[model samples]
Target: MLALPASADEARRSGYDFMSRATRAMQDEDAANTGMLWVKDGEALWNGKAGGANRACADCHGDAVASMKGVATRYPAFDARMRRPVSLEQRINLCRTEKQKATPLAHEGPDLLALSAYIGMQSRGMPIAIVMDENTKPFLEAGRETFNRRQGQLNLSCAQCHEDNWGRKLAGNPITQAHPTGYPLYRLEWQGVGSLQRRLRNCLVGTRTQAYAYGAPEFVDLELFLMWRANGMTLETPAVRP
Candidate 1:
């Protein structure tokens, strides 16, 4: 398991007030967790042979329950081969292309999301534990800058709505603290599960700013920073959201 911080306060925040009590309850109920469907599909994918090598993830990783537990909490990790930070999705794709000799799944595709949800589910209740070493520090700083920089026609930064005016209403919706613990979330608006990058893109569009493309370096950096900001928060992958 990933190591927890000495103090939970390292990046602690209030409970997820953005969600209603009923919605929160639904998230905790396995029967109601629509994201579990994806997890099930991912389980199948993990064991099934694929690609030219005809290898399965199980061939190398063995049981996901043991190997993947708490793995999501430490993601957007620094990869020496890539020489940069890579999100869980990026790492999954890397494995598909390089190790499995399979074509990489498209970003936000159903298969990719399913696999991501499966891996992430293994880390449920774990705290975010992104490493902040010298190699990752620069990206973290860049992410912080991006979070603070005012952009778009609205001329607002991420902190304005989330940090400064949390618990307030924005366009009839509650402004959340922008925590990323509950990701690959099943959103009512989209009527489907989506990655954090999808939500971030939506926020950018809401701010009337041109959103970054999927798999962009900026998005990965921002993800690393957000994970840092939410360090110590429990993993709530495949969470339900309004």
Candidate 2:
């Protein structure tokens, strides 16, 4: 059997400080992160013409630097047309199909991730500010339930590790408060950048739970909850993690 920390406070203090030490130094620096390669690709895609309309994102949105600033922090927002909450990835696809007359990129595909990364980079260092009004409450509640409900062969809930034992060591890994700040991140394990949904799927699998398909409602709801949980945390797009 593995030794456990006596308390959550002790675990938080003594566990390996991955955020500060193990992760690449200045991980979030655009010049340092390998993930920025995708962002560069996305910039090219934004300017280049595409699809039936022969319109680039720049055609409608103008310069992303000016139009997209701080836009990512408010995402996984409610989309009235879809009648659901949509992740930044989903929203990008929606625009591509509906407005740009372009084919929607596959979930977790290179181009999609690149575009999402590019957009997310604009919001780096901005605080997450997803609004939770009456309209959004139902989705938020569903996310809360998902976070708290135990599942999988291990029967663990997200709260068990992230809330109850945060800062503790699990299989020699220090568990931090699961924040969504550093997304579209370059993980040492993946050797490439990945989205929050990818990370969430890994967590679900770690507990031996059934992972939801990409773009599933459950994933969006969970993401919304996480954004709400990490409310006010600064964005760290393209961040490096061990």
Which one is best on TM-score?
1
Give the true-structure RMSD of model 1.
2.7
For each candidate, give its TM-score against the true structure: 0.94, 0.91
Q: Give the clashing pairs for model 1.
A: none
RMSD of each: 2.7, 5.8
Q: Pick the candidate with the highest lDDT.
A: 1
Evaluated against the true structure, the overall lDDT of model 1 is 0.86
Which 10-residue window in model 2 sums to the lowest lDDT? 8-17
Candidate 1, 1-242: lDDT as tens digits: 23436664554453355678888787889888788888898899999888888999999999999999999999899999899999999999899898889999999999999999999999988988888888988988898899988999888899888878877888878887788987788887898889999999998998998899999999999998899878778889878888
Residue 133's C-alpha lDDT in candidate 2? 72
| Residue 199 lDDT (model 1) | 93
lDDT per model vs. reference: 0.86, 0.82
- Runs of candidate 1 with Cα error greater than 4 angstroms are 1-15
